[model samples]
Target: MSTTTQNRLESRYAGITLEGYPHALSAWFIVALRFVMGGMILFAGLGKLAFVSGEPFDASGFLVHGVDPASPVSGLYAAMASNVALMEIINVVVPITQVLIGVALITGAFVRLAALGGAMQMAMFYLGGWEGQWLAAFDSTLIYALVFLALGAFAAGRIAGLDRYIEQIDVGGEPLVERFPTLRYLLG
Candidate 1:
């Protein structure tokens, strides 16, 4: 049986109480979510790497015409598509970065950094595929970005991931995070 603990959260900003609430979460659920998300992203990268298509991947066409014309960032997408060097860089970087992020999340290594990258990618996708309607704009990309943020905030990797052991590595008789406090921002 899972045990429940009482936890209170409070936050204030600019002389105002933003939030004061009690919340509970299941540790196992978070771990499962991480795995599922990682697998989905991994397969996506693999697909772009020719696992799904027999031909090479190209983002120029998507950047040129796939984006909704009414989207706020359509001009940006068009500009990106117009640049040959940038397109070449993006075509390779997108898939490779996705694979790296997926591996990091699955192995529970540098999860915070991976989550940041994932969130940023999802944000770009969300903006690139803008639906023009406010309600329609809240799509899977937005949800994925939020989920990545939540994973980083909760340090889900430590629950049953390699990060737990990584965090305990001795560095000059002190834990790695203790020795290098800045690492806490990258690994969790």
Candidate 2:
């Protein structure tokens, strides 16, 4: 290819600069973080669903006292715990969300939305653990949430994925994307 064409191709494949972000090292680092964190979330969520077959569980009795039906967020947990089938389904859905977020971050497709979703899932997971008074169990979920928040806030996918293409089409930037700039990283 001609030098011009080669350069163009390089820019396209390696990543095109945008507002001084694309190709930034931190962007790639965030991508790697998303990949690892996403996988971990997917694994844990799937494990929760799979626990029934491997071990005995009474979702109703999973958490009591401070986090039980009497606690502040008891209604929410009750809603979740009440539906054993739904909770089980959440297992499949949770991992699927993780897998998709991982794929999006790695491939740079719909990155902002994917990352936001992952963060929300992580927050929920963390809350679940917290309510149960299990900080050790909450740590991983909290970490995943922070990673996703970073990926979303920084638009890491622009470095080498479909996020760039999405940006060109003016579809990636949303209200949530704009809002991310203001949110501090508490989970990381």
- In candidate 2, which residue pairs get closer than 3 Å at backbone N, Cα or C atoms, i.e. clash? 108-162, 108-163
Q: What tens digits encode model 2's per-residue C-alpha lDDT throughout 1-188?
A: 22322111112335664333233244456667766665665555455544534753334554333353323466787677678787676646665676676666656677777778888876765665564554354477687788777777666666666656544443355543244543222111
The best candidate in terms of TM-score: 1
Candidate 2 lDDT at 75 equals: 73
Off by over 4 Å in 1: 4-25
Give the clash total for candidate 1. Answer: 0
TM-score of each: 0.88, 0.56
lDDT of 1 by residue, 1-188 (tens): 53466655566878977554344456677788888878878878878886566777899888888899988889999999999999989988988888988998898888899899999999988888996999898899999999998889878778788888888899999999999899889888
lDDT of 2 at 165: 54
Residue ranges of candidate 2 with Cα displaced over 4 Å: 1-24, 42-71, 131-138, 169-188
Compared to the true structure, candidate 1 yields what TM-score?
0.88
RMSD of each: 2.3, 10.3
